[model samples]
Target: MLKTLPADSRPREKLLARGAAALSDTELLALLLRTGTRERGVLQMADEVLQRFGGIAGLLHTEPTALKAVSGLGGTAKRAELLAVMELARRAAAQQLKEREVFSSPDAVKRFLQLHLAHKAHEVFCVLFLDAQNRLVEMRELFHGTLTQTSVYPREVVKQALALHAASVVLAHNHPSGTVQPSRADEALTQTLKSALALIDVRVLDHVIVAPGDALSMAEKGLL
Candidate 1:
C-alpha cells in the first residue's frame, strides 16, 4: 500500500518534506510502527491501533500487557519501541515541570499528571511537591483505592510535605471511571489537605483530576 502511494505522500517522505505537523495521526503512528502484519498495511494497522486505544492520549497510557493483546504489537521490537516512546514523552514532561514553575504552564501540569495517573485502574492520590520557587521537587503517590477524606490522611500528607520541605503542592488523582468532574468527596478531601498543609506554611496550588484522555484543574475552576 505504501509503495502505491505517491513518494511525497508516504509517511516518511511527507514528514521530511512538510514537517511532522503536516502528517495526520495515522501517518505519524505508522512512522513509529514501521511495518505491518501479513493481513494489514502499516497505515491500516496504525489507524486500527489508534482507534482501539481511543487515539494518542489513550495510546500513551497503554501498558505492555495491553500491547501484547494487540495483533502486530505482539512482536517484542514494536512493543519495546512503543513503550520507549511513551517513557520518553513522560520524562520530557517531567523535565519541563522541573525547569519552570509547575503552574506557569497549566497545560504542562495537566499533561504530566495525566501521564502518571491516567493509566491506573484504581483511584490513586498523588502529590506534586513544589520547592520555594514553585518548581517540581517530586511527585509521590500517597494513597490508592477509593479516595475519600477518610482514606487520604491529611497528617501523612503533612509529614511528606515537611520531609520534602515543599513550599506548596498540587494534589492529583485519577478517576478510573473516566469522569473529570470533582465529586463532593474530592472537594472535601482537598480542603482537608489544604488546612493540614497550612499549619506548616505549605500552600495547595491546585487539585488536578485526570482520566485517560482528560484533565481538570480545581484551581482553574475556582474550586481551590
Candidate 2:
C-alpha cells in the first residue's frame, strides 16, 4: 500500500521532494492515477497500464474508448485528463512553431512532426506551406493511410500550395514501423511532388521522414 511505503518512495512525496524530472515514467503515471483499487497498488496499476498500452508513445496514440476499459484508471475522467494533457502538449509545440521562423528552426519543425505523426496508427502525409521568405503559412495533414503506405497525390499537393499562395513547401510523413529510412516509393513520391510544384514556381524545401525518435531529411541526404 502507498500509505505504508517509505515516504521517499511514494509518488507524490518523491515528486515534491525530488521534482517531476527525477521520477520514472511509471512513477509519474502513478501520480496521475492517484489511487489504486482494492486488488492492486497504484504503482502496479500504472505498470500494467503502461505494459498494456506499449508505453508512453502508445499511450499518446490511445483512443478514449479504449482507455475507458482500463480498470482503476478512473474511467472517463482519467481518459479526459490524459487527452487534455496530450492536446496541451501538442498546442504548445504548435505555438512554438507559430512564433518562430520555421525554416530557421528545423529542429522545432521536426519535433512538431514527430509529435504529430510518429505515434499515429497509420501513415499521414502532411505539408508545411511556406511564404516566399520561407516563413510558415500553415501546416496541414492532407492524407491518411494504412500501416505501410499512403497515397500522395502530387496534383492535390500542388493545388493546395497554389491555393495557399505558398512559394515553398516541406513534406513530412511518418513510418509507423519506426524506420526513418526513405524507401524507393518515398523517394519517387518526393521527386514527383517536386516536379509538380515547380510548374507553379513553388520549391520543395525538404521531405522529412519521421519515426519515433528519429527523423531523416531528404535535402540533407542530397536526395532533394
Give the top-scoring candidate (lDDT): 1
Determine the backbone clash count of candidate 1.
0
lDDT of 2 at 77: 69
TM-score of 1: 0.93
Which lDDT values do the candidates have, in the order given? Answer: 0.91, 0.85
> How far off is residue 14 in model 2, in Å?
3.1
lDDT of 1 by residue, 1-224 (tens): 79889988799999999999999999999999999999999999999999999899899987678999999998899999999999999999999999998878999999999988888787889999999999999999998885432278899999999999999999999998888999998999899899988999999999999988999999999999
Q: Count residue pairs with overlapping backbones in model 2.
A: 0
| Model 2: how far residue 184 lies from native, Å | 1.6
